[model samples]
Target: MTQQTAPCAVTERVIGIIAEVLDIPPHTITPETRVLRDLETESIDLLEFGVGLNAAFGIPVADDTVFLTSLRVHLEEARHADADPYKMMAGRYPHLSCDRVACILRTLDDGPVLSVQDIADYVLHALRAGQHEKAPSHAG
Candidate 1:
Protein backbone atom coordinates (compact mmCIF):
# COMPACT_ATOMS: atom_id res chain seq x y z
CA MET A 1 0.00 0.00 0.00
CA THR A 2 1.09 3.55 -0.60
CA GLN A 3 1.67 6.07 2.16
CA GLN A 4 -1.78 7.54 1.60
CA THR A 5 -3.47 4.20 2.07
CA ALA A 6 -1.43 2.93 5.03
CA PRO A 7 -3.71 4.66 7.54
CA CYS A 8 -6.81 3.17 5.99
CA ALA A 9 -5.22 -0.25 6.13
CA VAL A 10 -4.34 0.23 9.78
CA THR A 11 -7.86 1.42 10.60
CA GLU A 12 -9.42 -1.56 8.88
CA ARG A 13 -7.02 -3.93 10.62
CA VAL A 14 -7.83 -2.44 14.00
CA ILE A 15 -11.54 -2.72 13.37
CA GLY A 16 -11.09 -6.35 12.37
CA ILE A 17 -9.07 -7.12 15.47
CA ILE A 18 -11.68 -5.50 17.68
CA ALA A 19 -14.50 -7.36 16.04
CA GLU A 20 -12.66 -10.67 16.28
CA VAL A 21 -11.79 -10.15 19.90
CA LEU A 22 -15.27 -9.02 20.90
CA ASP A 23 -17.06 -11.56 18.71
CA ILE A 24 -19.00 -8.68 17.22
CA PRO A 25 -19.89 -8.34 13.58
CA PRO A 26 -17.13 -6.49 11.74
CA HIS A 27 -19.77 -4.57 9.87
CA THR A 28 -20.85 -3.02 13.15
CA ILE A 29 -17.44 -1.67 13.88
CA THR A 30 -16.52 1.67 12.37
CA PRO A 31 -13.87 4.33 12.82
CA GLU A 32 -16.18 6.27 15.14
CA THR A 33 -17.39 3.25 17.06
CA ARG A 34 -16.73 3.61 20.77
CA VAL A 35 -15.05 0.61 22.34
CA LEU A 36 -16.55 1.24 25.76
CA ARG A 37 -19.99 2.33 24.69
CA ASP A 38 -20.87 0.95 21.28
CA LEU A 39 -18.93 -2.31 21.49
CA GLU A 40 -19.89 -2.69 25.17
CA THR A 41 -16.49 -4.22 25.76
CA GLU A 42 -15.16 -5.26 29.13
CA SER A 43 -11.66 -5.16 30.55
CA ILE A 44 -10.74 -8.66 29.39
CA ASP A 45 -11.95 -7.91 25.91
CA LEU A 46 -9.77 -4.83 25.86
CA LEU A 47 -6.74 -6.76 27.07
CA GLU A 48 -7.20 -9.36 24.36
CA PHE A 49 -7.72 -6.64 21.79
CA GLY A 50 -4.47 -5.00 22.83
CA VAL A 51 -2.68 -8.31 22.46
CA GLY A 52 -4.19 -8.77 19.02
CA LEU A 53 -2.99 -5.32 18.01
CA ASN A 54 0.53 -6.12 19.20
CA ALA A 55 0.62 -9.41 17.35
CA ALA A 56 -0.88 -7.97 14.19
CA PHE A 57 1.26 -4.84 14.03
CA GLY A 58 4.46 -6.20 15.57
CA ILE A 59 4.65 -3.26 17.94
CA PRO A 60 4.37 -2.99 21.68
CA VAL A 61 0.86 -1.74 22.50
CA ALA A 62 1.45 0.26 25.62
CA ASP A 63 -1.66 0.54 27.76
CA ASP A 64 -1.61 4.32 27.79
CA THR A 65 -0.78 4.59 24.12
CA VAL A 66 -3.58 2.44 22.77
CA PHE A 67 -6.13 2.51 25.57
CA LEU A 68 -5.51 5.75 27.43
CA THR A 69 -5.80 3.83 30.67
CA SER A 70 -4.39 6.64 32.74
CA LEU A 71 -6.69 9.30 31.44
CA ARG A 72 -8.13 9.96 34.88
CA VAL A 73 -4.73 10.64 36.33
CA HIS A 74 -3.79 12.86 33.42
CA LEU A 75 -6.96 14.85 33.89
CA GLU A 76 -6.24 15.32 37.56
CA GLU A 77 -2.73 16.51 36.84
CA ALA A 78 -3.91 18.91 34.16
CA ARG A 79 -6.52 20.36 36.52
CA HIS A 80 -4.11 20.52 39.44
CA ALA A 81 -1.64 22.43 37.33
CA ASP A 82 -4.41 24.69 36.06
CA ALA A 83 -3.45 23.79 32.53
CA ASP A 84 -5.66 23.55 29.49
CA PRO A 85 -7.01 20.04 29.63
CA TYR A 86 -7.40 19.88 25.87
CA LYS A 87 -3.80 20.82 25.16
CA MET A 88 -2.50 18.53 27.88
CA MET A 89 -4.54 15.63 26.60
CA ALA A 90 -3.58 16.34 23.00
CA GLY A 91 0.09 16.32 23.94
CA ARG A 92 -0.31 13.18 26.00
CA TYR A 93 -2.17 11.44 23.19
CA PRO A 94 -0.72 12.71 19.96
CA HIS A 95 -2.60 10.08 18.03
CA LEU A 96 -6.01 11.36 19.18
CA SER A 97 -7.56 14.12 17.13
CA CYS A 98 -8.12 17.47 18.83
CA ASP A 99 -11.89 17.19 18.41
CA ARG A 100 -11.81 13.77 20.02
CA VAL A 101 -9.86 15.04 23.02
CA ALA A 102 -12.28 17.94 23.35
CA CYS A 103 -15.25 15.63 23.27
CA ILE A 104 -13.75 13.45 25.98
CA LEU A 105 -12.90 16.39 28.18
CA ARG A 106 -16.38 17.78 27.79
CA THR A 107 -17.71 14.61 29.30
CA LEU A 108 -15.23 14.61 32.14
CA ASP A 109 -17.47 12.58 34.41
CA ASP A 110 -17.86 9.92 31.76
CA GLY A 111 -14.06 9.76 31.46
CA PRO A 112 -12.12 9.17 28.29
CA VAL A 113 -14.10 8.35 25.19
CA LEU A 114 -11.85 6.30 22.97
CA SER A 115 -12.89 5.31 19.47
CA VAL A 116 -11.64 2.76 16.93
CA GLN A 117 -10.00 5.61 15.09
CA ASP A 118 -7.92 6.44 18.15
CA ILE A 119 -6.62 2.89 18.35
CA ALA A 120 -5.78 2.93 14.64
CA ASP A 121 -4.03 6.27 15.04
CA TYR A 122 -1.97 4.88 17.88
CA VAL A 123 -1.00 1.91 15.76
CA LEU A 124 0.03 4.21 12.92
CA HIS A 125 2.01 6.37 15.34
CA ALA A 126 3.76 3.35 16.78
CA LEU A 127 4.59 2.06 13.29
CA ARG A 128 6.07 5.38 12.18
CA ALA A 129 7.98 5.90 15.39
CA GLY A 130 9.33 2.37 15.22
CA GLN A 131 10.49 2.93 11.66
CA HIS A 132 12.29 6.13 12.61
CA GLU A 133 14.03 4.41 15.53
CA LYS A 134 15.13 1.49 13.40
CA ALA A 135 16.38 3.64 10.51
CA PRO A 136 20.17 3.80 10.21
CA SER A 137 21.61 7.28 10.70
CA HIS A 138 23.67 8.75 7.86
CA ALA A 139 25.23 11.29 10.21
CA GLY A 140 28.54 10.30 11.85
Candidate 2:
Protein backbone atom coordinates (compact mmCIF):
# COMPACT_ATOMS: atom_id res chain seq x y z
CA MET A 1 0.00 0.00 0.00
CA THR A 2 1.22 3.49 -0.82
CA GLN A 3 0.93 6.36 1.64
CA GLN A 4 -1.51 9.04 0.62
CA THR A 5 -0.22 12.54 0.35
CA ALA A 6 -2.22 15.61 1.25
CA PRO A 7 -4.24 16.95 -1.66
CA CYS A 8 -2.65 20.36 -1.45
CA ALA A 9 1.10 20.84 -1.50
CA VAL A 10 1.21 23.92 0.69
CA THR A 11 3.06 22.44 3.64
CA GLU A 12 6.54 22.93 2.26
CA ARG A 13 5.60 26.31 0.85
CA VAL A 14 4.13 27.41 4.16
CA ILE A 15 7.16 26.24 5.99
CA GLY A 16 9.37 28.18 3.62
CA ILE A 17 7.40 31.37 4.20
CA ILE A 18 7.35 30.90 7.95
CA ALA A 19 11.03 30.25 8.05
CA GLU A 20 11.78 33.30 5.97
CA VAL A 21 9.43 35.60 7.87
CA LEU A 22 10.26 34.39 11.36
CA ASP A 23 13.95 33.88 10.69
CA ILE A 24 13.50 30.46 12.20
CA PRO A 25 15.00 27.57 10.33
CA PRO A 26 12.54 25.23 8.63
CA HIS A 27 13.83 22.37 10.76
CA THR A 28 12.58 24.13 13.87
CA ILE A 29 8.96 24.61 12.88
CA THR A 30 6.43 21.77 12.82
CA PRO A 31 2.69 21.37 12.34
CA GLU A 32 2.18 21.14 16.07
CA THR A 33 4.18 24.29 16.80
CA ARG A 34 1.90 27.06 17.96
CA VAL A 35 2.67 30.26 16.16
CA LEU A 36 2.26 32.31 19.30
CA ARG A 37 3.50 30.02 21.99
CA ASP A 38 6.18 28.10 20.18
CA LEU A 39 7.22 30.37 17.35
CA GLU A 40 6.43 33.62 19.17
CA THR A 41 4.84 34.97 16.03
CA GLU A 42 2.74 38.08 16.56
CA SER A 43 -0.86 38.42 15.44
CA ILE A 44 0.09 40.97 12.84
CA ASP A 45 2.68 38.67 11.36
CA LEU A 46 0.28 35.77 11.27
CA LEU A 47 -2.33 37.84 9.46
CA GLU A 48 0.26 39.14 7.06
CA PHE A 49 1.43 35.61 6.34
CA GLY A 50 -2.14 34.66 5.47
CA VAL A 51 -2.46 37.50 2.99
CA GLY A 52 0.86 36.63 1.44
CA LEU A 53 0.05 32.94 1.26
CA ASN A 54 -3.29 33.69 -0.37
CA ALA A 55 -1.56 35.58 -3.15
CA ALA A 56 1.10 32.91 -3.49
CA PHE A 57 -1.48 30.16 -4.02
CA GLY A 58 -4.26 32.19 -5.62
CA ILE A 59 -6.50 31.17 -2.73
CA PRO A 60 -8.26 33.54 -0.40
CA VAL A 61 -7.49 33.39 3.26
CA ALA A 62 -10.22 34.99 5.29
CA ASP A 63 -8.93 37.36 7.89
CA ASP A 64 -11.13 35.88 10.58
CA THR A 65 -10.11 32.35 9.73
CA VAL A 66 -6.55 32.92 8.52
CA PHE A 67 -4.15 31.44 10.96
CA LEU A 68 -0.82 29.77 10.22
CA THR A 69 -1.86 26.34 11.43
CA SER A 70 -5.34 26.64 9.99
CA LEU A 71 -4.00 27.85 6.67
CA ARG A 72 -1.76 24.83 6.51
CA VAL A 73 -4.67 22.54 7.24
CA HIS A 74 -7.00 24.22 4.77
CA LEU A 75 -4.44 24.17 1.98
CA GLU A 76 -3.73 20.53 2.63
CA GLU A 77 -7.40 19.82 2.01
CA ALA A 78 -7.76 21.79 -1.26
CA ARG A 79 -8.49 19.52 -4.22
CA HIS A 80 -6.92 20.23 -7.59
CA ALA A 81 -8.31 17.24 -9.44
CA ASP A 82 -10.68 19.19 -11.65
CA ALA A 83 -9.64 20.24 -15.13
CA ASP A 84 -9.86 23.80 -13.91
CA PRO A 85 -9.89 24.19 -10.18
CA TYR A 86 -9.91 27.97 -10.44
CA LYS A 87 -12.87 27.90 -12.79
CA MET A 88 -14.77 25.58 -10.50
CA MET A 89 -14.28 28.08 -7.71
CA ALA A 90 -15.44 31.02 -9.86
CA GLY A 91 -19.12 30.76 -9.05
CA ARG A 92 -18.10 30.95 -5.44
CA TYR A 93 -14.71 32.65 -5.09
CA PRO A 94 -12.09 34.33 -7.19
CA HIS A 95 -9.27 32.17 -6.09
CA LEU A 96 -5.93 33.67 -7.05
CA SER A 97 -2.55 32.06 -6.55
CA CYS A 98 -1.59 32.71 -2.94
CA ASP A 99 1.23 35.03 -4.01
CA ARG A 100 -0.83 37.12 -6.41
CA VAL A 101 -3.91 37.29 -4.20
CA ALA A 102 -1.93 37.93 -1.06
CA CYS A 103 0.08 40.73 -2.65
CA ILE A 104 -3.07 42.50 -3.76
CA LEU A 105 -4.85 41.73 -0.50
CA ARG A 106 -1.94 42.96 1.57
CA THR A 107 -2.29 46.41 0.04
CA LEU A 108 -5.78 46.64 1.47
CA ASP A 109 -6.17 47.62 5.09
CA ASP A 110 -8.85 44.97 5.43
CA GLY A 111 -9.35 42.62 2.47
CA PRO A 112 -9.48 42.07 -1.26
CA VAL A 113 -12.83 40.27 -0.80
CA LEU A 114 -11.97 37.65 -3.40
CA SER A 115 -14.63 35.40 -4.91
CA VAL A 116 -14.49 32.88 -7.78
CA GLN A 117 -15.97 35.44 -10.14
CA ASP A 118 -13.38 37.99 -9.15
CA ILE A 119 -10.62 35.49 -9.88
CA ALA A 120 -12.04 34.76 -13.31
CA ASP A 121 -12.25 38.46 -14.04
CA TYR A 122 -8.71 39.05 -12.85
CA VAL A 123 -7.42 36.09 -14.81
CA LEU A 124 -9.16 37.22 -17.96
CA HIS A 125 -7.82 40.71 -17.49
CA ALA A 126 -4.38 39.37 -16.86
CA LEU A 127 -4.43 37.19 -19.96
CA ARG A 128 -5.65 40.08 -22.10
CA ALA A 129 -3.03 42.34 -20.66
CA GLY A 130 -0.35 39.78 -21.29
CA GLN A 131 -1.44 39.36 -24.88
CA HIS A 132 -1.28 43.09 -25.42
CA GLU A 133 2.06 43.38 -23.66
CA LYS A 134 3.45 40.63 -25.83
CA ALA A 135 2.07 42.01 -29.06
CA PRO A 136 4.78 43.36 -31.33
CA SER A 137 4.90 47.13 -31.54
CA HIS A 138 4.73 48.64 -35.04
CA ALA A 139 6.06 52.03 -36.07
CA GLY A 140 4.70 53.80 -39.12
Q: Rate the local accuracy (lDDT) of all candidates.
A: 0.81, 0.44
What's the lDDT for candidate 2?
Answer: 0.44
Runs of candidate 2 with Cα error greater than 4 angstroms are 1-8, 68-140
- Provide the TM-score for each candidate, comma-separated: 0.83, 0.42
- The residue ranges of model 1 lying beyond 4 angstroms of the native Cα positions read 1-5, 109-112, 131-140
lDDT of 2 by residue, 1-140 (tens): 11111212344556666677788787886543445545657667766666555554445454543332333233334453423333333322333455544543354344233232232333233333342132233567
Worst 10 residues of 2 by lDDT: 1-10
Residue 87 lDDT in model 2?
39
Candidate topping TM-score: 1
Candidate 1 overall lDDT versus native: 0.81
Q: What TM-score does candidate 2 reach? A: 0.42
Candidate with maximal lDDT: 1
lDDT of 1 at 7: 95
